[model samples]
Target: MTEAEKFTEYTIPRKDTVYCVEFCGTETSSQLLAVGSNSKVSIYLCKFREEEEVEEFEYEQLHDLQNGCRVTALSWSPETSITCLPRNIRLAAGGSDHRIQIFHSDLRGNDSVMVLEGHTDFVNSLTFDPETGDRLASVGDDKWCRIWDKDGNQELTFPLSAQGMSVCWHREEPVKVMVAQKNGVIKIFSLSGQMQLMSFDTNQVPLMEADWCVGNKGLLIGAVAGSDWVMFDVSVSSRPVERRQIHVEGTRYFRWAKCHDSLVASVGRPGRQIKVFNAKSSQTPITLSQTVTYGLSWHQKLPALATGGDQKVHIYMFDSL
Candidate 1:
């Protein structure tokens, strides 16, 4: 009858607090999971196996890597291929040291990781371009959004009006990208000409994070600013179409479900209480309280939500209705 009772839950125990969670899917069948924590990033291969008539999700540790510093944000590169037997995977992780590390691993004993030197402040977020995983987009407290190629070369840099909070690639637009600044301004850019396409302001100042909707062709964008989360319809208005408060002190993270257009997840500070809400609804359907939590991520295909907790990674699958 209860929201949490109608779902299945999975947990991964770690030695330290998890700061971020990212799921990567492969054509070979299994899914790869990346969880970032203190000075290390743990990678796992996850899959759903049918036990009796019920489907059960399972994961196996594939890598326990030393990141050289506390990882704050992470993104999976599009170059990952699991169609062959060896299974090659690439992941980019940003650390507290204000650097980005690219981890290239495979089953064939050719595992190499490289550090990307950029951003004078702590890296806040990073995402690989959806069209070609070769390019990586990132934002940080350094007031810049920088792009890097697969070879670890910094190719482009875009100065921000404030501390850059989040950056993401448009899933549908091959050359479109977005950057959310802490001053509550959101800018959309065209990668082809490296020209600013559009810019909009949130309902309030101090935006913490923002995400692009998957179901919309980069039309709808969501962000967490101040104590409220707002959604912007770029094609319709220069302002947010929806804005509501879920956090009292402040909201930290905001993520739209990759598989669903109207579903979203957010983390509020003060207590780190996470909420799952429908875009059109005022009431949140599910809430999880983790006094000390860091990030929120949605499963690549399934209707599952994952979050980082104190020394653990928690995954939940609930009926969005």
Candidate 2:
């Protein structure tokens, strides 16, 4: 296993805890990052300066949105360019105010913004479609999953039996989405049919986070409440093909490396340990840090990782095995 070397660290200029962080572009065109903190979302522009054969992150603070509530979820639209339109960097965020807010970089510092209201409680997650970046999916504690168009119109809403925790779009199939619920069930829904296509039951504990394998088809990874990690192969069966006790306590965050097919990262309670596991093997993980990590995000284009906790964000560079 290859150890990840610490690249750089930036301390957020606030005393509040950071709930989430996300990159604003793909690996090929990433330009900004959005950080979700208490009652606001701050934007940072990723700048690079080459020094002694190393590229450093010189992120500049662009702006901050006062959401009037705790911002819990954030997602950026896919990078695209059309003939007649200017380049747009769209951001979607959900918060405790029970509304979803959409912002565009082109219209920053202006009154041109859209807010969609549907969830009755705190929204937990938000994800955009990979193909056209028009459709967005959001889930919340109110047991509702909603889909919205680029124009901020509600296209569809589904009522779930359990509270929703996270939602993710398939990398290859745009119409398919996976939603993790509090009752330990991950359901895959078809946007075209507005119906659930498949469901996987962890049956261990509540599922807080789930992500699809970007490099593999029909493979899913989830973080359970009992400090366990489970991998499911939908093409084979609904049951998990592999399960392992990841943490001594509970885990709430899980992210798959976009460029590495075998590497998966997870974080949990009790300490500041982040573990990177090989999806195909049951060997010991390559531990990253000993600091309490509340948030984890991987750069889409580079082998870099950003973790937020302890009032600071640490960046790391690693070589994928």
The candidate scoring highest on TM-score is 1
Instruction: Show where candidate 1 strays beyond 4 Å.
Output: 25-30, 49-55
What would the per-residue lDDT of candidate 1 be over residues 119-198, giving only the tens digit for each residue?
Answer: 89989999998767889999999999898887888888888999999998876887878999999999998777888889
Query: Residue 265: error of model 1 in Å?
Result: 0.6
Error in Å for residue 271 of model 2: 2.1
- Per-candidate Cα lDDT values, in order, are 0.83, 0.74
Where in model 2 is the C-alpha error above 4 Å?
A: 1-16, 25-28, 47-55, 79-87, 107-111, 289-292
Show pairs that collide, candidate 1. Answer: none
Candidate maximizing lDDT: 1
What are the TM-scores, per candidate, against the unseen true structure?
0.94, 0.88
lDDT of 2: 0.74
